[model samples]
Target: MARAPGFWFRQPGPWSAALAPLGAIYAAGTARRLSRGGRARVGVPVICVGNLNAGGTGKTPTVIALVQRLSDRGIRAHVVSRGHGGTEKGPLRVDPLRHAAARVGDEPRLMAAFGPVWVADDRVTGARAASDTGAQAVILDDGFQDPALAHDLSIVVVDAAKGWGNGRCLPAGPLREPVATGLARADMVLSIGGGHAQRQFAARWPALPVPHLTARLQPLKTGMDWTGLRALAFAGIGHPEKFFATLAREGVEIVRAEALADHQPFSPRLLTRLEGEARMLGAQLVTTEKDAARLPDDFRGKVLTLPARLRFDDPAELDRRLDALFD
Candidate 1:
């Protein structure tokens, strides 16, 4: 997978044009499979919290928020993911402490805290494990495109800032599936952030049949010092720009900022070099909580970590929708 920035934007020219016919054929086959309706074994409700666009549409945070809401209402929610970027083979349980980013993937590890989490290549297998574990509901993170495990509710997440990059798919754009395909299958559209993001969604999908809810991402109250301190911030998330923007909003002075691939694994040498760079620039080294989890335990304490959370401004309406999931 390509890194955050150019992965979505750096579309190929003539080469991709030559392959466009083939891409369309493949997309058609996959979309047809997704449209089928026979595999759904709805022992418990399966809610898919996904995004139409690839990379960072804040799908992880949305899943986390939904998991928390489900637990609050005395419902047992289990989470299942394909465990993208991890090396595991079959169905496996995600233990945040034991499994590194290489084992359970970045997002699954983060979601494991809110409920029972399972990772498997075959989502149906993962769902079976969750059901066996006594989970009343299964929240599939980033699995809307997968057709095997039928979802009862599919909520598509849209980043207000990026706005579905060039409105194209794969080599041409950021989407894993067509925008209309996701919208058609979705039960709701969650437009995240303010300003351009909200305006873009309103303009493009005003007549969508489902409810369009607005969400805001707020940094958790991390009592870290952000006052007038020069620092070097780095992230391997889908959208490093958001990370930098959050730091700026919190009054964190960024002297140097670096962006890497989503869920990049940094070695000891790389960590040492970053520390050296920070020291040379008279700044502290910092990164997002997702990146922090990948850092080796020996070097984790040396760097400052920032945690961010997604909060819905109007939560009452969300509560009602979540209630309907269990009903």
Candidate 2:
């Protein structure tokens, strides 16, 4: 996938202005598709964790966090995803031990580590499969724009650092649909990380009645001491810089940082080059959990994965929302 246009993050530039007409067309199509709502409903409650932007807004992590919360409340929640970047296109269960990221997609494989996961281009099929398999609830990762399945609750996640990105749609900007349309349907707005973009978004849409929640990605302990360690950190994610920033906060001495496109496939030649570079700098290889999931089996032991969890600003508030959904 191509990197998001820089103009998306800035105010409407000449390029965004030039493409505004195309954006209007895309927005209109989305609105029309959403209006034809004959969504298939499953037996259990379905919660959608999605975003308005085309790029990552930490949806996978949010799904994992919500699934864990559901488990804590004794709710068997299964996750449904489109399995982007993978070859599979079916209503299939993700077996983390048996499936590779190349087949099931990185996010689904990572989510499978937390709970049962289903991969399907048709989300309605995926949700039905989850329910048939005894899931009490279903979590739809990146499915807010998908109207084929009914959702009991919709929570839109926004990267606080990259809010709305010029607020245009498709080829013109980063949005998948217009922000106002998304907000109108959203039950809650989850702002992840701390940044001015989120503040600006809030100020710009003060009349929105959705409950706003704040959360941060907290790195989990890897049991390996990171202090004073020279490391070559690499990431293939929506924002690789975020991973690098997290490593810096953990006090890991980054000898080098490499940013690859989101969901970039790791070939043997590329892994060899990265390993050589790490060896040259006398540094250990470290990467985010999502990237680590895509590594070939041979490279698995050589790379250290930095796992992260979502820490809500108000745990009670999150609990109440979840409780309301389940109850």
Candidate 3:
């Protein structure tokens, strides 16, 4: 991933202050776009899982969790994404069996295992297509800031470890827009992982009106003996360290942790090198599900994947919110 500025997480420094003018411009442009909203509304309800930060805040997993919940409630839910790294600018349905990450992007390929996934640069087109097929509800993986499609519910996710770094927008900090402005549009604020960031945010804005929800990513029981297994863990997600930390939490002895740019394509040479390094260190290769989806077919069996699911602190509260969408 492109390295974030050091001052992003820290208190405002000279560099952040110097970049404040640009940040203001960026924030203003976002506000102006939001103000002139003409979002297309499909017949089915749309739930948006988005984040204030540019990078991953566990939005994909959150979407998966929500989809599962909707499925359990007998709702036919489908997912829509921007196909961030793919070449196709299409309103195409993702087929895990036929499509590679190169075609539909890694996250959509992974998400397709759960249900239908559609990739289109224009979310409205994708949502319309999904709804026209059989979708009772649509889940937007990102695009909280995009004013292209109307959303029934907007859930903004924030990583508890990296809450509103420096509280500045864009170039000055990590926020895509000002926190308050984004929060004003969000129906719920989901704090993923521990409550530290949520606590910090509350301290920063005690009067914030949005409902706060807490959740953590729990590793799905793979039924494999992972205890004491030495692993060379690597991830190419928005927050790779989070993946490494998850492996460590699951009792895997991490020999080395590698972080590549988000949605990075793993070439044959890189995979061979990673396998060789793992062998040299007497460790097995392991990666996140999204990264595993990007691996070539021949190399996939060689690497183990650690899959995780979102566990909400209050499922009833979430159910109530979801229920409101359909009601």
Q: Which stretches of candidate 1 lie over 4 Å from their true place?
A: 4-23, 35-37
lDDT of 3 by residue, 144-177 (tens): 9998899999999988777778989989999889
Candidate 3 Cα errors over 4 Å, as ranges: 195-206
Clashing pairs in 3: 1-261
lDDT per residue, candidate 1, 1-327, as tens digits? 457434354445665565556557656766887777767564888989888776778888898888888887888888889887788755788898899878878778778877788998888888888888898999888888887788888888888767676555665566677777778888888888866767876786567777778887888886766877787999998888789888888888999999888877887788888999999999989898878877877888988877878878677666777788777
What CA RMSD would you report for each candidate?
A: 2.5, 1.5, 1.4
TM-score of each: 0.91, 0.96, 0.96
lDDT (CA) per prediction: 0.79, 0.90, 0.89
RMSD of 3: 1.4
Best by lDDT: 2
* Ranking, lDDT, top scorer first: 2, 3, 1
Native-referenced Cα lDDT, model 3:
0.89
Candidate 3 weakest ten by summed lDDT: 194-203
